[model samples]
Target: MKLREALALAIGGDLAHLAEVARQLSSLGVRVEPGGDVVWGPTRLLGKGNNGVVVFCRSRHGDIYACKIRRGDAQRPHLLDEARYLQIANGVGVGPRLYAYTRDVLVMEYVEGTPVADWWRAAGAEERARFVADLLRQARALDLAGISHGELSRPGKHVLVARGGRAVILDFESARPGAQNVTQAANLLRALGLTPPLEALRRYAERRDDLAFNELLSSLLGQLKR
Candidate 1:
């Protein structure tokens, strides 16, 4: 089936409000083409989530972008959150670029990459350790900026493993300010069942000269043991 047809089927044919979504995208200058279709030229669907679909599209000017559309009530909030997070994470190197957003959709620079889950399963121990370190850096940056990715524990939703040792985060629908970075990291590690370098992770967060975060991780991991 065609992509549009497939999208319609995925979203449910009889669902209301989709027409409004399409119209909103047009008003936001998304270049709606003939046949009620948005021309994201040379784009493909990367993945679909429970409430939304993610597509990679090339703009008419030859720029690649990712478009995410959320369904029903999740549309507006997620769109706003993604836009804000992209703004915050722009120079942090842990997120995508925010281009445009409507009530139910978001457009950003496309990240060509793999999910961390698959990458972690296939990577060597060294690469895995590096990935963990990078993830910790990202968490620290978010913490410093006072942002928390609320759904970081959701399997494929948390981290996107890109080419060239680059990692990007996705799904900020629940991101909020004032979250505890250490607790978030612990939760993520526990959910993934991986023993992170907690001492190093803590030192990175605290910016200490000779602090031992591994001991902290050990302590935390031990707590989980009891």
Candidate 2:
């Protein structure tokens, strides 16, 4: 089935779920216009994940926003978690600003940028290393703040290389509190097929020096074998 058709079916058939979402949106001061076939003009589908669907929409105020709509009743908690995480992540330079959210719908500042994986594929090794280092810095900040993005390892989850060299992390549905910074960094590296640069990251965390960071990363990569 077509993607739009599938979304319509899910929204229409699930009245209770829709009502809950509407209630949440209302509480957040977002106006939900009533109509049959509510279509935002020419919405581009970015991608879909196990937790929710993401679509780019031009808001009534002429601002572009990434609208993430969750799929089922079971997914509601994840949406709520994302809302909570965004509250902490606002202005952190790690993720998008949470503009609005309901039980099933989330509106966020749309980050126009290439995914880190794609950027890394086209980038030279030095640029990729820099990107990795910058990501680690952002992760450390979140860790210091006691926030854990539960799905940080997913490829496409971290949107980078935005306008003006800004990187923004997206998709926080599974994010929680109280996760180890080192473990999260390890998992992200493993997912990217890079040896977990634990030692380098540790050095950077300790002394905030790039050269020491690279040496530590080399040592950590060596340790990953055994």
Candidate 3:
């Protein structure tokens, strides 16, 4: 289907509103087929979630992108907010790169990989450890940057293990600036069934022992590397 038509169908209601949206999209250099056929550039539905529906779309240059579109009734702040957070993540070498976005649509580098749970099941011990390290690194980056990923506690569909052993974190609508954060590390420990670190961190906090905490984290990383 034409891009505009597919968008219209996905977000139904008034034709005029859809036209305006199409116009805005066109201004952003987006091209849509008028023909009701989606064959020119194939699209695959990536997912449909509370944030929006994600589809893998190919550009004329044959580059694939993950396009996230806002549902008609999706609440305030829109895709723009999500786009902003994604930009932040991009700066720190986390998440997919943001290609472009308007008020209701987001286009970004398409990350192809297996979901975390599936990957975990198939990964060897070394691979699992490395993946865990990467996950913690990313979480630490976010926390240090003052960005809180509210859903990391229940990660769910948010993390992907890309080809070549890369870990990509997706979805940022629930992210917000915060003073201190523990969602990422806590959730990761929960997944790994490691509870001692949480308590160790608490003890370090009480004693204000930065070196001890660093040593502890280093010890954990070393074990994972081995």
Candidate 4:
């Protein structure tokens, strides 16, 4: 089925609202990539979550993007609101680069990467140290930006580790005003059995400065180095 055919099922809106969704896509000059994989969730979707259904779409200039369409029953069914939060995350170089957004749809950079857990398991000690350091750096960035990821404590599927070992955090639906990202990310580090005490990493959050975080990072790196 094509995007429109799939939309009626994905978005539980009435006929007019559905028509508007189609209109919006066309007016914005997006070319939907009809063919999709059936993995990651039900149907031929790229992925699905509480707030939206993600699909691949290309621009007129041939730039591919991930499109998130809001669900009718979504608790926070405002794609634009999510876009705003995502933009804040992007301000600090955190989330996928947001391109354009309407109330029902958000177009963003398509990250071609493997999930962090899958990548982390196969990486060596050096690679693991590199990833841990970068993740902590990003968590520190998010903390300074004041955007709490809300779900990083168990971020198994929330992080994508791409080629060249760059780790990109995904899914900002649970983000809010207060940020505890460093603390939460430390939770992930603990889960990975990275040998850092949460209490120590927790201090980095309190410092809110590069010197303190880097000192902690140096300590972690010292242990990671063999």
lDDT of 1 by residue, 106-169 (tens): 7777776777767766776556556666665676677667787777765555678888656677
> What ranges in model 4 sit over 4 Å off?
1-3, 35-42
Candidate 1 segments whose C-alpha is farther than 4 A from its true place: 12-16, 28-44, 73-78, 190-193, 196-226
Q: Which 10-residue window in model 4 sums to the lowest lDDT? A: 34-43
Look at candidate 2 and tell me the lDDT of residue 2: 54
Write model 3 residue lDDT over 7-112, tens digit each, in one string.
Answer: 5665544765467555645555554423221232333356666646676655666666777767665665467878888888788777889988988778887787
RMSD of 4: 2.2
TM-score of each: 0.71, 0.69, 0.78, 0.89
Error of 3 at 121 (Å): 0.7
Q: What lDDT score is found at residue 127 in candidate 2?
A: 58
Say which candidate scores most in TM-score: 4
Q: Is candidate 2 or candidate 4 better by TM-score?
A: 4
Candidate 1 lDDT score at position 67? 72
> On residues 184-217, what C-alpha lDDT tens digit does candidate 4 reach at each position?
7777776776666555666666776777678767
Q: In terms of TM-score, how similar is model 2 to the real structure?
A: 0.69
The number of the candidate with the highest lDDT is 4
| Candidate 3 total steric clashes | 2
> Each prediction's Cα lDDT score?
0.61, 0.62, 0.65, 0.77
Please give the ranking of all candidate structures by TM-score, highest first, separated by commas.
4, 3, 1, 2
Error of 2 at 182 (Å): 4.4
